[model samples]
Target: MISSYSEYKSYLEQDRIALGVRNDHFSSKIKDFLFPNYIWRFEQTLRKLEYYYNCKNSFWSKPTYYYLKYKFRKISIKLGFSIPINVFGPGLAIVHYGTIVVNTNARIGKNCRIHACTNIGASGGTSHAPQIGDNVYIAPGAKIYGKINVANNCAIGANAVVNKSFEETGILIAGNPAKKIKEIDIKKIIKHI
Candidate 1:
């Protein structure tokens, strides 16, 4: 939720830091553009759209909001991402440009480093979805669903299918049904965040 410009900027900066990007203005504008990271661009449009949506009374807010919304949709489609606005907190890092579909009702906390081919969605055609905690790392090809709650500083192993709640923090969960593999230091998994 970006209610103000300062908070929006802070969220964007945190997202950049989570993505291991240089925070300098020149680096953000010149370096990122020259390379063209679609994931980063999607995050930027997402943040800007959220900001404009919150502050809708500005003279240029409506047009800017529509433009950002269009751009966001385009990038999301290209990257195969179906993430909704305000679902993820600050410090969101997408690992790759691939299939990463999230349920609209899912609420993920801060510093979530999610890889591609991951799906955080609802089950049984219901709206109930996983509520993930902060500093969580979702590895590639992970499928987490249901109305489960994952604790903070957790790591979901690659290709893991999580269906139950892992309430204990600082642990690694994996497998088809998803079991707690072991207690781990999340910092080792996500060094930048």
Candidate 2:
């Protein structure tokens, strides 16, 4: 359970390190703290939150869902301006604190790391969402738009703009219009981690 902003920040830092990003700009202590209940209930409520945040096209019949999600949103807005997507499997690990926008249509996989200033959205009028695979590491300021499929074990470099489909694994993608930089040795990164 995250008790304070510092704890949240620490989690983000650990996630970044695990993703092999050598940086340390995510540290900040929490002062004038409020919302103690959120700290206690975060872990318990996380699963349900992820469900609601992910099922964009589905509607729930239960009243409890609405109440709990409403309360959670209120607390989240008060604590910080984070709108966490209801992603499946452990939720998304935010590596930095900033205005990050993830579209409701976008589908992300488990254990994905999203840095600050990243925008994951759809193209003009297209309902087909971006299907992202597991263990993908997206760098800060990257913009991924359209109904692109990013395969598992891929690293999206900083400020890259990805709008195409990639089927290859263990590659580094970079540039305004992202292209494969080189095939990474996933074993090396795993060993380093």
Candidate 2, 17-121: lDDT as tens digits: 444443334331132133233332432354454444434234553466677688777755544424454442233455544656667777777567667778888
Off by more than 4 A, model 1:
23-29, 57-60
- C-alpha local distance difference test of each model: 0.91, 0.63
Best model per lDDT:
1
TM-score of each: 0.94, 0.65
For model 2, which pairs clash?
53-86, 54-86
Write one digit per residue (lDDT tens) for candidate 1, span 1-193.
8889899999999999898877577767787778887788899898888888886767866777788888889889989999989899999999888999999899999999999999999999999999999999999999999999999999999999999999999999999989998999999988876
Query: For model 2, what is the error of residue 147's alpha carbon versus the real structure, in angstroms, after optimal superposition?
Result: 1.3
